[model samples]
Target: MDDDEVILSTPEEISAMAEAVKENLLPTKSRRLYEKSYEKFMSWRSEYKTTSFSENVLLAYFNSLIGTLKPSSMWVEYSKLKSMLNIHHRTDISQYAKLIAFLKRKSEGYKAKKAHTFSPDDLQKFIDNAPDYTYLLSKVAVILGIMGACRRQELHMLKIDHILDADNTLVVNIMNTKNRIDRTFTITGKYYKLVKKYMNLRPNTCTSQNFFVRYISGKCVAQNIGINAFGQMGKTMAAYLNLPNPELYTGHCFRRTSATLLVDAGGNIMDLKRHGGWKSTAVAEGYVDNSIQNKKKVSNLLMNSIEKTQPHNATTTYIPETELVPVIPAPESHQKNITPTLLPSETEPTQTPLLSQIQQDSDIPINTAASRNGNITPTPLPSDTETAQTPSLSQIIQQNSDIRINTAASRNGQTITISHNTIHNLHLHFHK
Candidate 1:
């Protein structure tokens, strides 16, 4: 070693080198904490700092030989030390190489699997049973995503005016989209009317010009309803519906479901891509693949094949009724025993003779039972004087017909007797 080549051995020289590393901390949280670690190293170096000491001396200081900073803390400290000395200073710190490698090895251990996408049935249940607000949000999200294949962020930026056309067709301007391209999506009959209603009723104001404005303090504002808000709403909706764990389907699932269902419904893949502003056909193709797989699964469950066993059991087991069951009619063969009956009100003669007056005054002429439902043959009425004298005479003529009157009681034996009226009493025959 040449005399001109300076060797860093003095306590002050070693302390200054460590302090330089701490002062030049990188831009990240825990930078202050890591700087303290460097300061501690420098303080200890005053008593033991030396250029001749092997890499073991540096490891002892880093591992905190005086204290127990195991596994997690040790890795944090090791990373900062290595980053500052090796990366920043570009120093050949060979001693700490093994420690750095050891920490990285542990970090590469098994990471938890990410949550899976929503199944078709599960998604349907979640949407169908979601709370009012959440249901509306989910519906709009699905329709927009499926029709236009909208991203979560794109949906956040959607304005009411984006949906165009007087007809059912919707035209979404893609300037706010991820790809910055315009596209139009056709709304189906089920969703078109609702989307139209929502657009017309959306909050409007001067301060917030966004289509979906938030109502704050009874004033409409252009504050963005976060993408996370939609996700959180979904979670709340899932809980309300009592769905399975991880019931909350994220916004991305809406996009996936839309693509899958559309293709399954015989939508043109090329057209779907164009309207969705997709740069390539990969995503569209994936939708088709997933659809086919789902179709196969459903078909396997529904189809009854003589060659194959049933998906469910063939035996029908009856479950005992735990609650009261109301008796319902069975499809057994029987005749209904019915008899002609009349209410007392219907059979009894009215004291006021209201029925007789009603019959005489009615435009529809009443007929006897023998003539009912048949063409009536009218008989001429008796002379006016005879008819006028017979108010109660109609009732007697309807029952007893052999009414005799001695003409001697009137004048001489001239016998002036005549029938005045005729009435048919349906009840009289029943009584007899």
Candidate 2:
């Protein structure tokens, strides 16, 4: 075959090439998990011959792991096994109704507990307790993992060239992330200083291009740190700090802590998604939901900021507690003498009465002589025909000389006169 020409392959070679391509399509971590899951299944199959790629066997296998493994781990194992079986048998095991129902029931009944995240105080304590130069790499790893919101694999895979200094901010270019998408985040404040310190102390004897290397006996031993080793450093730091359940704070705690801190600081969800390389807002929301105290703080801020105050002229009155009094029943004699005052009829006074002017004017003193005698002679009102024929006030007084103009105080404390002709003029003047 010529060097530039492609050779025709046999059937076995073509099949091998197809299998290799299919395996390469899966991520490295996922392919390893599938292989491990298949190995465990094969080991179980040796003891139980009836165990095959069936729903019953799979359910039984999951049930066996209930007490030993966590719900999340068991679910992952089941997924891996299902995927492996599907690829090998060319059948979709996830499509089985019974298996899907069983998985749903298991998920609903069993909730996996998450690990405790590191707070700012906890991180500070861990950094302060660094014993030697070798462990400073661990400190740098943790700081970068938290400040960049990077996973363990991403931290381990960071290369020296990925760190770019742009003025005061240091930019970290993260590759080989869980989502297989490249993301760049900036580090400023104290975290930038930490990265610079680690770089200054980096072992010159190590020929690795990777940013983080494994240091043994004050010398760099490996080109890059392993994922397990990076995670173990988190556990070690937690133990050194005497944190609660040190084993629970893994390398992933950095990512969780970073997301929680950003949200608590009022970071936008879209910005968080881009910063953390999250595929959906739901993931960012989940991280924020874990921050119960921050949620309560935000709720209190909203309640206080948007609170409405009562108007200055509001009718409602607040009685002081000390001035509250108890009521006592009146005696029978007092109760009988207390008569309810009748309210004036709605049709009684659409317009003010003519005598109301006398009551309003302080210059016009009320005559008390007739009121004291309790004799209020009702003044005869003018007939409607006489009212229409009546002239002005001066003319009425001039024409009616025999008319008795007696001033009697009415019940409403106003003086009334007994004159039929002058009544129409008073009514019109008062009403107008």
In candidate 2, stretches whose alpha carbon ends up further than 4 angstroms from where it belongs are 1-13, 39-57, 64-68, 124-135, 214-224, 239-241, 298-432
- Each prediction's TM-score versus the true structure: 0.38, 0.61
lDDT, candidate 1, 269-386, per-residue tens: 7866775677778856654434556678668766745435633434443334432222222111111221112222332222123223323332112223323333443343333232
Residue 319, candidate 1: alpha-carbon lDDT: 32
What lDDT would candidate 1 get against the real structure? 0.49
Highest TM-score against the true fold, candidate: 2
| Model 2 lDDT tens row, 1-432 | 212224543466666776787687656766787888888887887778864677777777777777777667767887887777766656577777887676677678665566568777778877776654656677787788878888888887889899998886898899877787789888887777767766766666778888887666555554667778877777877887888788988778778888888877778888789878898888777765366768798799889876556554555555454433222222233233323222333333221233233223212223323323334443442333222233332233234332322111222234433232343444443343
Cα shift from native, residue 235, model 2 (Å): 3.5
**CA lDDT of every candidate:** 0.49, 0.64
Q: lDDT, candidate 2, residue 250?
A: 79
